[model samples]
Target: MAKNMYSLMLMDEVVSQIDRIAAQSSTNRSNLINEILADYVSFVTPQKHIQNIFESISAIIDDVAALTVQDMAASSVICIKSALSYKYRPTIRYSVELFSDNKSLGELRVTFRTQSAELLMEITHFLSLWMQLEQHYISKFDSKDSISYAIEQGRFKRTLMYPKNSSLHNSDEVSKAIADYIQMFDEILKGYLNGEYNTDADVEYRYLNYLKSGLTVI
Candidate 1:
């Protein structure tokens, strides 16, 4: 386990309520508070970690253009790898079982969802050519669980929103989908650049440099 470093701030009212419940549960308020804090971080980071990873990547990219995946700082590396609880199985794993019927014990293994094998394989193949993936980015579609994806990318963006969300807070499938959506945007942006698609103001990713390569000032 890596070192967990961050400030702790619990609301006064919440602390008071925790004290009352702590007395009944035979647990100290601090212990309860810490448990809740851990739960929140565990439940939150995996999905949003990509943004934080990307932000760190983007910042260093200008100064450390030669930086490879291995060059990322330990903290960043931990944060990024912690997000890959599925694909990094064995070393970092998620368990799964498949059944011929709901009650029948058919198969079991340390892995993510089996229904996602094809998509997961697709992402794995794409990632093999890219940098060693630290965190997998995800995006969702209207169908939510049914149409989801994950993508391996060079850069990540956004940070503050990394620890807060409702629908995606505890769903791995949604994370996979979100990754796919981002990859789709990347593909769209690439196609538009290669003249495969018409250029439009509303580019999915809207990278001005990659979009037209003509936006700059003296």
Candidate 2:
């Protein structure tokens, strides 16, 4: 959305109320006013769209016992946390950040805070293998150039792409796709880390079956 500078005259009492609400919402006065005006005009601004998507994601994952949504004040980002079934029961965090621009949908970041060298090495290997699998499969649907992947010591990040079929500006479908993808990724990662998937072939087979299950990939 394009923004511009504008001058408006409002009563001091109204401004005070807007300020109070903005503070409560973790936003500034200008943004609160903008959202109010946008709502009044029924305009779906990028912020509003992002909020809708987050709400949809929350709804979709509400029944999942393994995933927990973290409280966030920002509208463009949602954070979910899940625990790994390892010896120390390390926590893994997944953060989804939606973009307002057209460059892409947004980014998914999976991060863990662990001091064990062995765990870090395992995570790195798993992330590398996961990236290769996604590159091999997702490229068939989207241009390989459109997707981005990165892996560090305890983090894996991927750029999300808009669904190829329907623009589906509606947030429900898009949010559901994202939520499902994260759940699948989390399950596979936990399994791999827990020694359930002992071989690369075993992991690949599981992933291929998931791809064949007709879930929308983004």
Candidate 3:
């Protein structure tokens, strides 16, 4: 959304009340006021879209065992936290930032963290292969360079475009995409780290099995 500077006059009591609410919410006064005005105007802001996406994701993955999804913040830049399947159960953070002009599309970031050097190296290898697989798979949809991944120290970050297709016109479609991505990623990573597979072919086979089994969350 485009922002503009505007001068307004308000009563002292109203300003003080807004300040109190802002302090309690741990948000700056300007942001608090913006949200209040956006609500009053019935604008479907990016923050609202993000919240809907998070709710949908929660519903889709709620049944997965040993998994937890949390909304780190209910704002335009929504950070979602999920527990990955690992020795120490390292957590993955999905920071979703939506563009106000297009509520159906956004940037989805998958971030992983672990302390062990060995595990980190293995994860990096897995991420590289995963990137190749996704690139090849999405190419069938005529997508070009829509997914990217990077690794630094103990963190692995994979960024992908949400609603890869603009036709994914609703919150449900976007939510399903998010859930499906997380499930596929978790399954393949755990399978690889658990010594269940050694090659890309094996991973493909497992993923196909997952599709046939109609399991989108694990």
**Cα misplacement distance, residue 39 of candidate 1 (Å):** 8.5
Runs of candidate 3 with Cα error greater than 4 angstroms are 71-74, 77-91, 101-104, 142-145, 162-165, 208-218
lDDT of 1 by residue, 69-174 (tens): 2332322221111122233331212111112221221111112222445535643443332212112212221111221123323222221112223333223432
Cα lDDT tens digits, model 2, 1-218, are 77898999999999999999998889999898999999999998888999999999998878899999999757788999999877778899999999988567899999997788899998888888988898888876662336889888788899988756558467888898899999999988888887889888878988988889987778
TM-scores for all predictions = 0.23, 0.95, 0.76
Estimate every model's Cα lDDT from 0 to 1.
0.34, 0.87, 0.67
* Model 1 spans with C-alpha error above 4 angstroms: 1-166, 199-218
The residue-level lDDT of candidate 3 at 112 comes to 72
Name the candidate that leads on lDDT: 2
Better of 1 and 2 by TM-score: 2
Cα lDDT tens digits, model 3, 43-74, are 76666666677788778777876456675554
| Candidates by lDDT, descending order | 2, 3, 1
User: How good is model 3 by TM-score?
Assistant: 0.76
Candidate 3 least-lDDT 10 residues: 138-147
Question: Candidate 3: global Cα-lDDT?
Answer: 0.67
